[model samples]
Target: MIDPRTPVLVGVAQFVDRDSLSADALSPLDLLAAVSGAALADSGGRGVVVDTLAVVRLFADSSPAFRSPFGSYANLPKSLAARLGQAPRRTIYGPVGGNTPQLLVNLLAESIRSGASDVALIAGGEALRTQARAQKMGLALDWSEDPGGEPETLGPETRLVSAHEVAHGIAMPTAVYPLFESALAAHYGDDPLAHRRRIGALMAGFTRVAAANSYAALPVERTADELITPTDDNRYIAYPYTKYLCSNMFVDQAAALLLMSTAAADAAGVPVSARVYLHGSADVHDMILVSQRLDYHSSPAIRAGAAQALAQAGIGVAELDHIDLYSCFPVAVEIAADMIGLAHDDPRGLTLTGGLPYFGGPGNAYSLHAIAEMAARCHAAPGSKGLVFANGGYLTKHSFGVYSTDHPANPARIDPTLLQAALDAAESPPFVESPAGAGTVEAITIPHERGIHGPATVIVRLDSGHRALAVIDTEAAALIDTQVVGRRVNLTPGHPINHARFE
Candidate 1:
């Protein structure tokens, strides 16, 4: 018999608002309330009782660029709950990271397993598409609110980017992710042009998946060549990455999930067919800074997290019937698939809600949609197992969960603290902030802003057996056209940022 305290997901709801624009656009808060209410109603009326309510961090609150101009909420979680007429004993405001959704699941599962929470209502949404429209058209919006009462914050509020990275022009995901792709391209021994086509072909599969998903923002199917080749519509955002290849955060989307203990679900009269068990779950983080990592092409965190989650489920990657690896960029999916031992072209497929790029990247809440999708797939397949892998902070944080509809026995799980410590203790070279000498280029990114290529950002391994981040302030054309990984570059230490040039 399954443990009474075992947590199971009973309801999920997703929404995509494509029609609204400017002032008519629903705010993130509005979307959150609608989806949360829908999720609870999906759990069979008032059958499920929510003792805890968690809200994923919004894009506006998560980043400076997306900061809401119409004022702010004093208590976002409570703001959302009040709309549902709920006064949950515990209200949580999630931290900044795409890993948060799955992280919240693993955390709430532990809570339900311990009998701390009978049921939980978790929800979040993004209205950047609307926000952008308002800003560009000089329209007015009022997103401010004060729901009253303080809600506890969830997860770490750690800084996502370091000052050194900023100095080197590695300011955002678009710029940072290409560092990994460049290294991956070199590792694959493909020339600049071939590697572009190779990744283009890989992401073309995602576009096809998106075409079938009603919730997908860019639901239009695109060819491999169409994705890679730049034009007026598909311009290169950063080096080796076109606009189509990156995550589309500018979306008006929302999703909600309901989790309850088996006892609570049974008491709520939830159908057995509707319940999905959390068979395994784990969360892990790599060296917080990209500069501190040992390399750019791979992720130890993903390898460890995937292994641990599968171990807890008493299965292997091969045993999973369905899968969705976070696809913020092509490199993220490639590295995660490699780490988890799944083939790039696995017959079962790699995404559930298409991917972040196609389905829609709702800031820190993208994986929530992935989880909701995974639960639906589990219900459809009954005993079939599904896995959702969520990534955050430039592939720095990872969360994994295994799901199935059948009553599950205790599988196995390592103490997360123990796993984390081992990962933290992994051998890493010293990080050098200043450098002056010959260095081997480990990765290269020539960012494009406003339709023009840039002074390149380069990650280098100095002769001192340490890593240094530097910039090439000129000759944007040469760097963009050629493969620079493994090539020698000379560094000249400068104020604010160091400079690098081909030897």
Candidate 2:
């Protein structure tokens, strides 16, 4: 039996790939209206109006003028109100994070369970490509970024990384992900070449999916060699990751969801077609600094949160008809798969929208696309279930949810904060760089004065050595002239350390 407290997801919508917004092309506001209408329509053409609206970032709409007390994205809350033609009982200009979509849904579900509101809507969009094209074509557009008035005071708990991280070489996504990639390679005792090949094969699967997904931003299938091979067209962005394996954020797309209480859905007469229930959700975060992590190979947040969510939904990985693991890089997918015990080649596939790399990472909101696809899958599969995983701020945080067409057995909502607390207390060890000893050379990323450079490869070690990543410090020099990839090397700590090729 469906628990009385169970919250039903009645509507979902998404948009993608437009060079320009045609007359039929929904403007940001119009897009919101259409999706809201679609959600309500899906809910059996229910007459119910939203009382609460949670507006996630409209990526293409981030104009300097839209800044407000709620930060730059606050305008979404008020703008959604105007578009929907109703006074929201409450409006949230959510904090920035890729996990915002699922987080907002979790908050709305709690509110419904608490009787704080009867119906709510969560929406987000990105039009980076569209705006760029419009400007290049000399079309005048009035996208507002300034949301007038004093900004609301941000809460004390939220912390952004220091400028030093950015000033240094660690701020970029490709750079950041390599920290985990290198660690995982070392942990697994694999040579850089083998690791690169594995990652290439994994991401090629996503590219194949994107080729089939109409909404994919880079909808072209990349061969494993094309993906991992170090060539001018596909250069190494980081040591273990190449350009094709990284997330693609430069795209135009948006997605929205309509969530209503079961009581509200019943009152509106929304049909079975539009209804997907939240069986369970778990939200958690790892330690803030990647350097401070106890274990680089695993994400405790993913393991704990995913377990809790699946347990709450009363289902196992094998039973889920659809699964959408976050795929910003191969490590994200590998960590998720390892934690959840899903086969890398599971027939269900790892993503519902190709993945962030091909589907496009809309900053912190790409998972919204995943959730939308998962909802559609539930609709298509009828009694089956779906899972959506979202990551935020450098894999530092994670949230997982399970949904189904069946009524939820346990109607109560578990506090995600409790899960976050557990993660906070979990112990992790510090990652210490190894002092050079005899070992094999593997793939490496070297920072240069101009740009990040590499032609990384696998190398064997001599004299009871250890394998470690290496980079040659040079000024835009040729790859062959650079220090050895196959020769033995001394890694003495000194000026920029050393990777001298031993005869």
TM-score leader: 1
- What is the TM-score (0 to 1) of candidate 1? 0.98
For residues 1-503, what per-residue lDDT tens digits would candidate 2 score against the true structure? 45444578888877776454442333455556666666656667446788888776554333343222222333666766776776776777666667778878887888898888888887776655655555566666555544443222123334434433333344455667766666576666666677777788778888888889887888898888898776676666665566778787767677778888888887888776788988888777888865445555688888888888888888888888899998888888887888888877787899889988787886567887888888888888888998898887767778787888888887576767777887788764422233355544433334322235642322223344333333334332344223334445555433333343433
- Please give, for residues 228-250, the per-residue lDDT of candidate 1 as tens digits: 98888888899799898999999
Ten-residue region with minimum lDDT total, candidate 2:
65-74
TM-score of each prediction: 0.98, 0.82
Give residue 315's error in model 2 in angstroms.
2.1
Q: Model 2 clash tally?
A: 16
Please, what is the whole-model Cα lDDT of each candidate in the order they appear?
A: 0.88, 0.68
Tell me the spans in candidate 1 whose CA falls farther than 4 Å from its real position. Answer: 20-22, 411-413
